[model samples]
Target: MIEFKNLVKRFGTRTVLNGLNLEIREGEIIFVLGTSGTGKSVLLKNIVGLLKPDEGEIWIDGEEVSQFTEDQYFPIRKKCGMVFQHPALFDSLTIYENVAFGLRRHFQLSEDEIKARVGKALNLVHIQGVEEKRPAQISYGMQKRVSLARTIALQPKILLFDEPTTGLDPVTTTAVNQLIQDLSKKLRTTSIVVSHDMNCALSIADRIVVLDKGQIVALGTPDELKRSTHPLVKDFLEEVLHA
Candidate 1:
């Protein structure tokens, strides 16, 4: 339910997104794969209206949002929930407070409603019994789960994940990948995950989009990508397989 048409973003002499044309279907999990500096995160930012495109348009739910002002973009932003590479949780706030932060800012709800939503969000991420603890008191994986919980609590229509499995052990990476898959299936939230992790993409993607030099190099199912002959796609897959 999102479409990008001839999208372009430039910073000085460097062009990050060059005529990007993509369509993300509703309830589909798309994994964007690329090396560093390939505009994967830029794509996410553009989709969320954090960074505006220099040319072309971005459409969400059939509405063009490229020219929307901050006031007009507020509701669109709320419909999207982003999970950064880092959890970005507040060290000073307890887990429950952190998860409740957005809900409090955006909506006026009774304490009981807030508690139930927070509890359900945590359960969705398979996190439990840490509501009273601070972020520092939890493991890195748990902290990531809390970050996800906070986002899911908003009941967003779109979920943007940037490097969701970064900086974790293999076991935790597996857990996080599985969590992404589970959440996408259960929530049906049009998830777009930006990651270079081949295993993660293969494990979770309904389709994989490969970016290179500010452009889409390939887009296909995991099996199709595995059989691709494009030089860049082949090289990238080889590197991931060997690394």
Candidate 2:
């Protein structure tokens, strides 16, 4: 459903992503694993046109969008829903309003339709009640779920996650990982997750792509990665094993 060819991104003297190439299949969960500054988040941003590639092409659903203007990229962004590292929910908006915000803005739906979508999205994330409460009232994990509820309520065909479990405790991280897998399967949307957790990736991802210096160093299923001999892949595996 998504492909990147010879991709490159730079900031003045620094090249973050270099000659990166990969493909994400439809309805599959693909985890991108790398240490800090390996261009994980940059990769996600490039997909939704938050950042443009300097040298390569980005193809989504067969359309090359490396140079699409902001207005022209609107439809592409509508087809992709990105969950940022921060929940970034409005403090004043109630949970329902927060979830319904995108629906109201991007779509022309009645109050009843909005309510139905809000309910279904919250239900998918296993969040119940608290519709009238604000972001400050809920637990952080629930807040994150509400954020996810807000994104999925728009019903995008592709889901992009940038460090979805960044600050969570281990249990919450596991729960969030499971939720990603479940949502991808249930909604039949292709998922691209930029994360640092290899253990969770092993248990949940259809494929894992390991990046080093903005290039793919290892790409395989969990079992295939277990036998990888690359130093970076081994380093990641060591951390996972010793954890």
Candidate 3:
């Protein structure tokens, strides 16, 4: 469903992605694993057109989006939804409003339609009865669920999660991971998750892509990654396991 061909991105003198090539199939849950500053999030942004590549191509569902103009990119973007490390909820807006925000911007739906979709999304994330509360009124974990609901409400064909389990307690982290797994299966969306959380990656990924510096160094199933002999991959596994 997504392909990156010789993708390169640089910031002034620094290169973040160097000839990165990858293909993500439909209904697959892909986890991008790497240390900090390894361009995992940069890759996600490129896929959704938030950051245009300095060189190479980005194709989504068979169309090259690398050279798409902003107006041209709009519809392409609508096929995808992103959740940041920080939930970034509008504090003034109620949970209902927050989830409904994207729908309001992108579609002409009635109050009843919006409410039904928002409720369904919240339900998909196992959240309920907090529709009237502001973001600040909820626990941080709930805030993350709200963020996921917001994205799910858009009915996107693809979901990009940047550290979905970050900044949560262990139990909450597990909850978030399960939610990602469940939603991916339930929604059957092609999902790409950018995370350094090894446990989360292991539990949720159908395939794992390991990045080092600015390029892909490994790609495998969880079992294959566990049995990997590559130095960087072994070191990463050892570090996370011992942490």
Candidate 4:
């Protein structure tokens, strides 16, 4: 459902993504594994038009969107839901309002419809009984789930998660990874998760793409990656093995 061809992204003197090409199938869960400064997040932004590539094209559902104007990208962005490294929730809004915010702004829905979507989204993330609570009143992990609830409320076809497991304890991280797997199957949405956790990738990803500097150094399923002889892939596997 998504394809990048000869993609190149640069920031003044630095080229973060260089001649990268990747194709993601619909209903697939892809894990992007890379160290910092490897253009993992940049790749996600480019997909949703939050960032544009300097060279080559990005195709989604057979449409080339590299040169799409903001208005042209409106629907594309709407079809994509991104969960950032941090839960960028409004401190002032209750969890219910936060989840309902996108629905209110993007679609003309009745109060009853909005309420139902918010409830369902929360339930999909395994969250419950915190609708009236503000962000500050919830645990950090719960707050993250609320953020996810907000994204899924829009019923997006593509889910872009940048460091979804960051800042969580191991137990919470494992739970979140399993949730990603469950949601992908339940909603049949394409998921691209940018993370450094090879362990989680192995447990949940349909495939893993490892990036180095600006290129894909390795790409394979978890078992293939585990058997890979590439030095960087070996290093990542070692970390996972010893973790």
Candidate 5:
């Protein structure tokens, strides 16, 4: 489980997260929804230990992550995986090499083991035949799949997705959404997604947490969010519904 207790982060005069408190349980898919600049991405960065909180504690499975040193964070980071808004693949590398990048850099595995792991990761995302192909050769949807394959290759206990379906068409968006849900269930990994796309959120989120000005304004399942009486939520939902 991941818990953020009274977390606070500031950049000079700007406050990104203000006493942010949240709980993410194991094997659950949690979605953080908000308008742009509401600090949703910053919250994800804190959870992954990329940024430090100026105040309060972050606990991952009972360990005080806020107090962890760089060395301590290394092992913890391995247990977490992240998929950025962009596919973020290296254009020069083949799909096989891209997926194997982390394993080679972080682990002491042999060539045979690396190959096996890379192949398995690709197969998990239905991209087995694209191993030798460069990332630029594939469609945008396929690039996203390759990115997901790289993330799952780490076998993280928690997966953080930042707008996974942002640029895809409705069909591709639906496919990516289903893939997120399927991969979360199959791997039993805790999934946390940050998105403004209600379709993606409603499709895959087991629970939704809405933020306004860096504070949680509502938390509930998809149905509850859709039927919420809060004007702020209703307005946001309506905008997405129409878009």
Candidate 6:
């Protein structure tokens, strides 16, 4: 489980997160939803030590992530995986090498082990037989799946997704959302996804957290979110419903 306690982040004069408190349970799919610039991505970064909060702590599986040094944070980071807003694959590397990159860099695994792991990860995401292709050679949706495959290659206990369905068409978006749900259930990984896509959120989230102006304005299941009386949440849902 991940816990955010009084977390705060600021950039000079601007405060991006304001004493945010959240608890993400183990083996659950959590969706952090909000309008643009509400610090959802920043919160995910803090959980994995990519960004240090200005105040308070981020606890992952009972360990305080904020206290870990760069070297110490490595092992902890290894236990966690991330899928960025953009498919941040190395364009120069082939799909197999890219997916196996983490295993090669971090583990002392043999060539056969790396090959097996990479192949299994790709197969998990239903993107087999693309190992020789470069990132630029695949479609955007395919690239996203490859990125997801790379993330799962680490066999992480926790998976952090930053806007997983951002730029895809509705059908492709649905495919990614279903993959997220399937992966979380199959692997029992604690999945925390930050997204503005309400459909994706409603589809995969066990719980939804709505952030507005650096604070959690609402937190509930999809049904609860739809039934919420809070004007901010209702307004957001109404807009999505109309759109």
Q: Which of the two, 1 or 5, has more lDDT?
A: 1
109-224, model 5: which lDDT tens digit per residue? 99999999898888888876888999889999999999999999989999999998888999998888898999999999999999998777887799999988878988999999
Estimate TM-scores for all models.
0.98, 0.99, 0.97, 0.99, 0.96, 0.97
Residue pairs in clash, model 3: none
**Model-by-model lDDT, in order?**
0.93, 0.94, 0.93, 0.95, 0.90, 0.90
Q: After superposition, how far is residue 65 of candidate 4 from its true place, in Å?
A: 0.2
Off by over 4 Å in 3: none
lDDT of 4 at 191: 97
- How would you encode candidate 1's per-residue C-alpha lDDT over 1-243 as one tens digit per residue? 999999999999999999999999999999998889999999999988889999999999879999999999999998999999999999999999999999999999999999999999999999989999999999999999999999999999999999988999999999988998899889989999999887788777999999999898999999999999989788878876886
Query: Candidate 6, residues 37-79: lDDT per residue as tens digits?
Result: 8899988888788889999988888788887899989888988
How well is each residue in 36-131 modelled by candidate 4, as lDDT tens digits?
A: 999999999999998999999999988999999999999999989999999999999999999999999999999999999999999999988999
Cα TM-score of candidate 2: 0.99
User: Tens digit of lDDT per residue, candidate 3, span 64-133?
Assistant: 9999999999999999999999999999999999999999999999999999999999999989999999
Q: Say which candidate scores most in lDDT.
A: 4
Candidate 3 has an lDDT of 0.93
**Candidate 4 RMSD computed on C-alpha atoms after optimal superposition onto the true structure:** 0.6
Q: What shift in Å separates residue 146 of candidate 1 from its native position after superposition? A: 0.2
* Consecutive 10-residue window with the lowest summed lDDT within model 5: 196-205
Clashes of each: 0, 0, 0, 0, 0, 0
